[model samples]
Target: MYLYDHYDQAMVDARVAEFRDQTRRRIEGTLSEEKFRPLRLQNGLYLQLHAYMLRVAVPYGTLSGAQMKMLGDIADKYDRGYGHFTTRQNIQYNWIKLEDTPDILADLASVEMHAIQTSGNCIRNISADQYAGATADELIDPRPYAELLRQWSSFHPEFLALPRKFKICVIASDTDRAAMRLHDIGIQIVKNEAGEIGAAFYVGGGMGRTPFIAPLVKAFVPLDELITYSEACLRVYNRYGRRDNKYKARIKILVHELGVDEYRRQVEEEFAHLQTLAIEPPLAELERIKTFFADPAYEAGLSDDLDLSNPAFAAWVKNNTAAHKTPGYAIVNISLKPVKTLADGSKQAGIPGDATGEQIRVMADLAKTYSFDELRVTHTQNIVLPHVRKADLFTVWEKLVAAELAEANLDKITDIIACPGLDYCTLANARSIPVAQKIAERMADKAEEIGELKLKISGCINACGHHHAGHIGILGVDRKGLENYQLLLGGCEGADTSLGKIVGPGFDEDGIVGAVEKATQVYLANKEGEERFLDTYRRIGMNPFKEAIYG
Candidate 1:
């Protein structure tokens, strides 16, 4: 993890002081809500349906154990005793007091975290692969570049008030775990045929009322021009992007209105102009950032074997762990989604991505004890102990099991990615959490059979839950003044990114859950050997699943 320098500390400290005064003024009635709206939003405070919500940034989803512990402390001290981890690789507290926000910011500042850019129509938190440095498949660790972009975009005067909020993702792997193509700006660091490293720019990807998989704007941009090219893309969007309508203000909308070729041409022209400005950070600075991400010390000649004698531990190891780039080590994922059976024998779903303060503290302790004192928040609303020794797998699993955090359902139907829908978000049309819970319970028994299914839910079209990218996506809508859920299929967020298509007419809450189960049953019955739910859906198409569900 990168430690904050003096300049970084100074800026955060200054923002805290500034916001303290702003918040005081709002509370004292010296500042009107209309006036304080943007100011509070700039600092990541939102007035939700019931109470104020505070979103704290976890840059690229990386946090030190101490930071994670502080997050737990914040949850305990300020709001309710739980925090909601979001799809943007950030965390949110649903019940925040207006007067206590400054103190919360101060607490976060001490840990080198803040709420800045977590909201508003500005560049939001930069996201990346959760297993960036430790994963076996990446070409290079992309966090350094992500950090550089973070520093560059933080309060950049030019982008502070864009036509709409912009999101950027950096991934070095070809597997696309970060949903690279579904961002406003997706930069994939790649090696060319000449064996030189560069970036492939995919601009104009987003999901909302309108969903778009950004087209490849530039196939290869030299490493030296990464920041400049990114700025060029933003400049183009800012210059011509629509300001009249909030609905069509995102860069994705601009790219849709203008063809990819023209957008690329404009970006190229801007890139040429930015080259003279020398806006890209110097190579020395990137090298300095890279130093923070170097591999942890590993004992040489360690064995890469796990004892699978215990059936429970074997299941956890099989589902929640991934191969590490270093031998004898593994990437461990802690599932936040825990399913509980009520005394009535009905299933009760633990709220997805909502980790209680005690659970967060437990995870922090585990990270410190096992994973080099580091933890990562995945885009799927899970946490990752990026580098855990294989020898300690069982102990870690045991600890997680004791904490009730070991769910052994990674990518399974039960491992759902859903937003805090009508429950917390005022913009939501229907309840998303209940729908997610129902689906999880309905499919829990068959989740192992329906393997590698990415199910996502959003209360509205904002796509905060990333429903557009799920293998089976669910969207809640307001239909005839009632909460209706729509089922979508064939969505995938990996390397072959594709938006889900709605199967047919919307259904009521129970109907939607049954519809999802029917779709899965179709997959199980028709699937070839070893085929995932997504593979089966693609091979068999929507007709079979649609007939089963609607008929």
Candidate 2:
């Protein structure tokens, strides 16, 4: 949680004043809808299907308990009772009035949060691993780097209007929980053989109409040159990336047109020129940023006593928990997967289509109480109580179960990631959420057997849900308004990341879940005892799943 200094505070306050004037002009008929489009977009406001949607940035997905309370207050006072957490770890309020946006921004500014760079062709939010500081396996926390990038890229004149939206991800651990390989620029922080820290750069990776795993650009970019090298890569893309055709404007398209080798060469040439000016941040500045994230004081010798016999607590610990760097604590994921349905029922789960005000309040209170007065909306559509004490695991689980938020399946097959498709998004060509729900429902009976399968769905080729990185990928497309889904197998989201390969022809909405069921059955039939679905898929390739799914 980086706090805003006077400089940062002044910038936000000035932006709010500017947007206030802009809104007044628009309302006064001086600025038309077309004229206000870019202005509003720059502030993360969008005119959606029914109402205006305002996306607030949760920088690197970090927030304090007080900040969470502020967000809850915003939800209650400004829009509807609940907020929709997006795949990028940002939160969206769908029913905002146009006039109230500036006020909302002011409210967010009070908590050192804002809506800047959340949309538009400029660099979007710099995301990192959600479990950055807490994870036991991380070489270093990636948030500080993410924060550095945020400061550098925010309103940077050179990159304010790139060819298309630019996204960057930083991962510090061996595991790619942040989906580092699926961004415009992905940096894996690694310690070299001599034990010096540096970044491994990957470029031209994205998931949209053209999905690609970023090719390696530099094996080891020194820590001092990260910003310089990144600027060089962006410069190359900005100069040569497609601008005439919006369809091919992304850096991925440029890389596809000019093979990876040539793209690497171009970036190298640019990097060589900028390397001379590269300088590391001052030690004092680095220490100042690090201070914001200093480890919270914990009682010493906390790991020595433990009771593992509580079955409910043990199940939650085993499934939704990850090892923390601290001995006495664990990072807890508050599962949003409703146990009422399997894959296909996600759309119908949680607050139903006809949910009332009371239900939304209950959901909000559940977050406020059990989750350290703070909750992180994960990229996987689940909420995380990232700092839950190990001792309180049972109490949290009990509360979550009462609210239908406890599914006991954190990485299992039923915990599908899906986007709002034709149902909500005007850009979608096919429905995605319903299809994901149906798949979840189909696999409900064999939920435990499927074991840690990631089924990701994208409504269209835009790949917003990152279907390409799923262990099992489902892409929905439209054929004359009829929903058709294409299944891809063997994708992974961990350290050994790989893009999924498409199976056979696409299946109709009715047939897609059956196809998924068949694929899972194939996995069950072929898997050795206790072997996860991903391990089985990797060991035996896609043939078995393909045969079963298609046949």
Segments in model 1 whose C-alpha atoms lie over 4 Å from true places? 342-345
Please provide, for model 1 over 448-522, each residue's C-alpha lDDT reduced to its tens digit, 9 standing for 90 to 100.
878899999999999888899999999999998999999999999999999999999999999999999999899
Count the clashes in each prediction.
Answer: 0, 13
TM-score, each model?
A: 0.99, 0.92
lDDT tens digits, residues 393-479, model 2? 677677766766666778777777877777667678888867776776667658776778988889888888788889899898887
Where in model 2 is the C-alpha error above 4 Å? 275-283, 304-310, 341-348, 351-375
lDDT for position 533 in model 2: 80
Q: Number of clashing pairs, model 1? A: 0
In model 2, the Cα lDDT at residue 524 comes to: 83
